[model samples]
Target: MSDLAITLLAGGVGGAKAAEGLAASVYADSTHIIGNIADDDEFHGLWVSPDIDTLIYSLGDQIDRQQGWGRKNESHQVLNELEKLGQETWMTLGDLDLATHIFRTELRKQGVRPSHIVHRLAKRHGITMPILLPTDDVIQTRVKTNLGALSFQEYFVRERCQPTVNAVEYEGASIAKATSESLSQIEKSDVILLAPSNPIVSIGAILAVPGIKDAIEKSNAYVIAVSPLIGGKTIKGPADKMLTSMGKTNDSKGVYECYAGLLNGFVIDDQDSMDATWLETQGVDVLVTPTLMSSTAEKAQLLSKVIEFALAHRNVRAA
Candidate 1:
């Protein structure tokens, strides 16, 4: 088990949930989490890497359980001050959470690599398992909507995902180079899992980085994706609507199509067992289980099943 490396591509609350599960599992020491940074944006002159910070907060057991992101027992005095100064005051960066942004911004200003900052923050939070970024380059998610092209945070947070999405783009991804640590992890991993994050923005943004998808395609690891949709709808985010708006199906099959050629297996909820059965017949492994991570026990249970499924069919492609 010490030599068995597990790598996870993750972002958002769903990704954080997956990270928490893997971090608490027996493979915690061997697991590497690669988070999405496309949702990163600047507020009050400070850089905020939402996905990465969420992972750190969640793993450190400091996440606001009710809101699912931000630090627990947080205060908004900073935001209140900004509001008094006529700032937009929409992003809602809590006082405690603002410390992370300030540290990250200062590090970025001093020319530290974004990937290194992620791990440093994770370590400082008492999180041992490595939390990494896919690239050191600045790649952002841009959604073309009725309100024009808005940044990932603008669409998801500022607008509350209400505007109709015309298209989604990973800005700067066309030439953004993948970090060596990400590729190295994929190469050394025995199992690679894509968290049940948004297919279009979260996981999609990570894959959009040059060489990341290629590395996964060429890796010897057993790669799998956990669907974010259940019964053709998302539990939290707008993945279902976004998929449909992007002219893709919103069901389990639609979610699988997003990863088309890169997956050996997929995990869907029990409600989509019929879809799973059909997928299994198409030379792809499928796992059917309860994917809603409503509790810590449930999250681990889902991941444990995924690990068992991967082990039973490890390196099947090479065979």
Candidate 2:
């Protein structure tokens, strides 16, 4: 029954877990998620928004918990057929999951905005919380490696993120405008959370959009981020490897540095307590907790601590 309206910036499995936690909390109705669209791409003439759909499926409780993406009980018949036809099926879209992409592509063809499509998709999945896109424009993540620049999907899925990371870029972010809904949500929120997604590709791409970072910087809300790294490594994805490859520390302290000026506080795993004192020296409040959201109860527990931490900062900011 709290009055706080939370707007979360998120992407990938970690992001979904954070969103799941908040969706199960008392502030569920007041939570709005702004998801990354930079990881989006086309597969077989159908627009595939991986990060956005991950949020939708996860929040809808239809996600494949084992794979951490796509739908539960999904069939890959379509992908199998495509492979049989000599199509490069590295992306691996299940039959049921392809339906979402087809629907989204059709809507886009008919001139529907991406945000509106996401709203409809969420509603169809019985998700009550809002899922917002950072922009309606095409902003994609491009990874530059020694092998050459690859699309985020190519680097992530095709090569299995094995490329030696040289640089990461959001292709259209320099000119892309932030969606009105996303900016307004940030302004209206009492608390803003940066989910424990891949900072370089997921959260980084969101911030790369022209006005989103400015909106966060100017917001009066308490901004907090959860570190995806636990003891200098990620449970999923190549975030830790990317961080290290890009000349950044692969720990909670590095996560804080990534969002340095924007955050009022940071949530790290209890095992990373060693870095707490140094983080405090940099003038950011640190909250060390068990950030691994392995179970439903654990997700809720982590979010409960995060909420409490945010409330404390909100009070101080208000005072």
Candidate 3:
């Protein structure tokens, strides 16, 4: 349906994968993405939005396929120079990737809205679909670990997620102003999907923005979430460890509980059929399929099923 509108709440590599899948699917032109900016940090005096850039690079066909982030054919000349200058180069920014951070920082200094900057960046990358930001206001993810509170980048990229996560705080999210574009998209969408990103940090950071969750709850769109876990473990990242540390069940069912009443359906991998059954018993529509996105074809395959499930549910609701 060309007229159908879809909105995605996404962050991190999993989010990028889901965005890519939708970009490759029939809904490419109609899909709108709201990405997490909680992982954003300033490095070398330049602002960097890791999750948002990953989504843009992935959708624009410029993402490094191997790492699931950053641009392909990238060179780290800038990072090397910074290293020689005795600057902390722990957060690696490639020569080309540095340009994105530069432009974004400049825009921010000029008082440009974060949402407009994302739209501009997406257009520059040849991405036609809208990449909306959850909020134009500044919000960051602070991880309270055994080593003390660390910025999301420090805990993730610098420390390699080795520290125990005691808690996660979305600094400024409660006071952040939700972007009108994002809210409008949620209101008009026929379907909204929470990509298989880390429920605690990635998707959690997005939902922490006050108006976002409320908008999703109030919207008529059929909301669905894909579990990031397969066999009670994440293929990549510290979602499982964080979940356990935060006293949540380390499985797909826990992932569902994170969103609770916001979801109309939940999608889990075939390995997590137990969770599927549990979710169904709770009166939630469940879709069990192979959710590991190893390639574009696989991503599209999974998304196609999710779309089918959404359509089916809509029909049932209508009946």
What's the CA error at residue 258 for candidate 1, in Å? 0.2
Candidate 1 is scored at a TM of: 0.97
Ranking by lDDT: 2, 3, 1
How would you encode candidate 3's per-residue C-alpha lDDT over 1-319 as one tens digit per residue? Answer: 7789899899889999998888888878879899999999999999999999999999889999888788999999889988999999999899999999999999999999888899899999999988999998889999999999999999989999999988999999889998889899999989999999999899999899888898988988899999999999998888998888888899987888898888889999889987767898877899988999998999988887897799789779768
lDDT per residue, candidate 1, 122-164, as tens digits? 8889999898889999988999999999998889888999999
Residue 103 deviation, candidate 1, in Å? 0.6
Query: For each candidate, what is the lDDT?
Result: 0.90, 0.91, 0.90
Write the residue-wise lDDT of candidate 2 on 16-109 in tens digits. 9999998888878889999999999998999999989999999898999998998999998889888999999999899889999999999999
Candidate 2: stretches off by over 4 Å: none
Which parts of model 3 have CA positions greater than 4 angstroms off?
none
TM-score of each: 0.97, 0.98, 0.98
- Ten residues in a row with the worst lDDT in model 1? 310-319
Superposition error at 264 for model 1 (Å) = 0.5
